[model samples]
Target: EAAIGIDDSFYRVGGDSISAIRLLVLCREAGFELRISDLNNTSTIRSQAARALSDDVISAPGTTTQYAPFDSFDEETVQRLKDNVVPGIGLSWDSISDVAPATPLQRGLISETLRSDGGDAYVTWKITSFGSDMDAERLRRSLVQLVGSRSIMRTRFALDPILGVVQVVLKEQVGEELVPAVEYCTSASEVKARATAVSQDQRWGRPQTSPLHIQIISAQGEATSMVWFSHHALHDGWSFSVMEQEWRQLYDADGEKPISTIGVDVPFTNVSRYLAGRDNEDDLNFWKTYLADAEPVRLASGSTSGPPPPDANAQKTITHTTKCDLSSVARACAVPPSTVFLFALATALGLFADSDDISFGLILSGRTLPVDDIARVIGPCINTAICRVRLQQTQSAATALQQLQADLDEINERG
Candidate 1:
C-alpha cells in the first residue's frame, strides 16, 4: 500500500524508484497525470497532486500515429516476412501493422526459449470472476476491441536467418485468436482440469503465438471466470493495470454489442524505437568497465549465486526457511529493510566465498527513456545491470549499510 498524506515519505511507506513508476500509472488512470520528476522531488500526495495535470488537461492521445517501419533488418528478409512468413503464422498481409526490431530483453527471452525447449518461465496467469449478469458476448467483443487497439497484444517474435530477431505486428485479431470458446463446467474437478490445461498450454513458450490469451468459463450456480495468462512481453503488471481499467469500463458500458470505439495510449513501437536510439557504444562501454573486474559469484554453500561448479550439481540437499522482521534493525541502521537484507546477504556471501570483492546484478526497471508516458508504456521494460561491492570485513553493520546505500545511490544517479 502507498503512503497517504501531505508529507509522507514514499520510501518509508514501501515505495521505491521502480514502483513509483507503477504508482504514476495508477495516479494517471484516476484522471490526474502524475509526473515522475515531481515525485522524485517531493514524494507527498499534496505536493505531487498539486503538480499533477487535471483531467481537463490530460488528453488520451489514442494510438493512431502510424509509426515508421524500423529499418534495421534486411529489406529482402523483411519482404519475405511480409510475403510468406506472415501467412504461415496465420496472419493476413492486410492485418500486418508494423514490423520492428525486438527489444533486447525480448531477443534474450526468445532465444532462451528456443535454446531451452518449451521454457515458460515468464508466463503469468490472472483470473477474474463475474457474477451471473456477465454478458459473455459483450466481454468477448470488448476483448477483441482491446487486442485490436494495442500494439503489444499483436506482437509476435520471429527469428531471422541474417536479419536477427524481429517482432511482427498484426493490425487486429478477431474472434478465437484471443477470446476462445466458453467452457461450461458443472463440477469442481472440471475447473481443476481446466486450470491445469491453462498452465501447460503450448503457446506460452512459442514465439509465434500472440503475447496474450484469454478464456472464459461458466460453472453451474457460480460466477463466470475469465482467465488471462500472457508472456511477460505483453502484460507487465503496469500495462495490465491500465488495460484492466479500460476493459472493465468497456464491459460495463455496452451489453451484447461490439465495442468499436476504443481509447489508446502511445504505441509500444514508439517506445521501442526510442530505446533503440539509445543503444549506443557509450552505454555498452560504461557497463563493460563497470563490471570489468567482477567475476561470477560462487556461494561457499549456496547455489543461487551462479551455476554451481561442474562438480556441485546434484551433490546434496539443504532446505531451511526462517523469517524475521528487520524493521527495528533497519531503523537502527538508518536504512530500509531491503537494504538491510542486502547487507546481510553480502556478509553471508563474503564469509562463504572468502573474497573481499563481490559483484552482483542490480535490475533496473528500464523505463528511463525520455518518451511520452514511458512509465506507463510497458513492453518488456526490464534490465539487469551489475553492482560491484568491496566488503570492509571489519566494519560495523551500520557503517556497511551506509556505504552500500551510497554506492547504490551512485549507481542510480549515474547508471
Candidate 2:
C-alpha cells in the first residue's frame, strides 16, 4: 500500500474541477467506487492510494487522471475583450498633492493600452472585527463602495481608435473571497494606522506595466490592508498612493464625500515624442562602444530558454530584486543616489549574466522633466532605456559606476 502524506504523488495532486470528475470515473472503472467529494476530502495522493488498497483493488498505472493544460485566450479574443472591458488602474505617491483631472486625450490613451493588455487586477485582504459584533457582508460592501467612488478605482476602457482614449467604470466585484477574519484584541486606531502604513509600502516603484494587487488580513480584531500598484507601464508610485488614501478615506467615512482632489500631470506623451526625435545613431553608438568586445553573459541558468516552442501558448516571467546599502551606493564612484541605483542595478545584471555581451532594459520616469504635469491620473508614462554593459575581468564596481554615470549624464544632457 502507498503511504499517505503531503508529498505523495497523486493523480489529482494539482487537478482542477474537471480533472477531479475524470479521476472519479477512472477509479470506478478500476472496481473502486469513488466520488469527487471523496477526493476533495482526501486531497493527498497517498490518502487516496491507501483508500484504494483498503478496498482490495489494484488500479492500472495509466488509468490515473491527468489535469488538462490551461488554455489561454487568443489574441483576437483578448483584443475583443480589450475593446469591450475597462481595466483597473493602480497608482502611487511620494506625497499627497492636488492636480487637474485627466484630459480627454489622456484618458483615451490609458483605455487603449489596458484593452490591448487585458486589464485583470486583484487586491487581497485580511479582516478583523474589533467588537463582538461583525458583519462580513457590511465590511465587504464598504470596501466595494470605497473602490467604486474613486476615478482611479473605476476601470478604464478604450473609446477611440486613433487616439486610444479610455473611459472609466466602477468594478462590480473585487474577485474571490479568501479566508474569514480571525478574532483578536487590537484597538481600531492601531489597526487603521498599520493599514495606512501597509498601503504606503505597497505602492510600486515602477507603476505602469504591472497590475495592482491589494492584500488584506485581520490581526487581533484589527483589519490590515496592503495595496499593490501595477508596473511602470500603467501608473507610478505617487499616483497609486493617492488612490490608496482615497480608498481608505472613503472606507472610513462610510461613503462620505472625499476629503479633496489633488493630482499631478506628468507629460508622458512629450517624453515619447522626445525619445522618438532622438538620433538613433547616438544610442546605437552608446551600446556598441560600451559592449563592443564584451561577450553576452547568461545570468540565470534558464536565461537562454529561447522563446517558447511554436504553438506553446504558455507564458513565463522572471522577476529579480537586488539591493545595495546606502553606504556602498555612496562610495561607488561618488555618484548621486540615482546614479548609484542605476549602476548597482547594472552590476547586478552583469553578475547574473556572467557574460560581457548582455543587454538589459531599465525604466526611467518621464516626470523627471519639468514640462510634464499629469500626476493624479493613472497611466503609462515611463520609458525603457537599454544598456549594454561590458563585464571585463579587470572592471571594478567603482569603474562600472563611473562608466554608467558618464553614460547617464550624456543621456540626460542630450535630452
lDDT of the candidates, in the order given: 0.64, 0.42
What's the lDDT for residue 149 in model 2? Answer: 37
For residue 69, what is the lDDT in candidate 1?
62
- Give per-model TM-scores: 0.70, 0.38
Which segments of candidate 1 are over 4 A away from where they belong?
Answer: 1-15, 18-80, 84-88, 118-135, 173-176, 186-192, 203-205, 255-263, 301-337, 393-403, 406-415
**Model 1 lDDT per residue over 291-318, tens place:** 6777667765544466658764556767
**Candidate No. with top TM-score:** 1
> Which RMSD does model 1 reach against the true structure?
6.9
Off by over 4 Å in 2: 1-155, 159-234, 246-296, 300-332, 337-354, 372-377, 392-399, 409-415
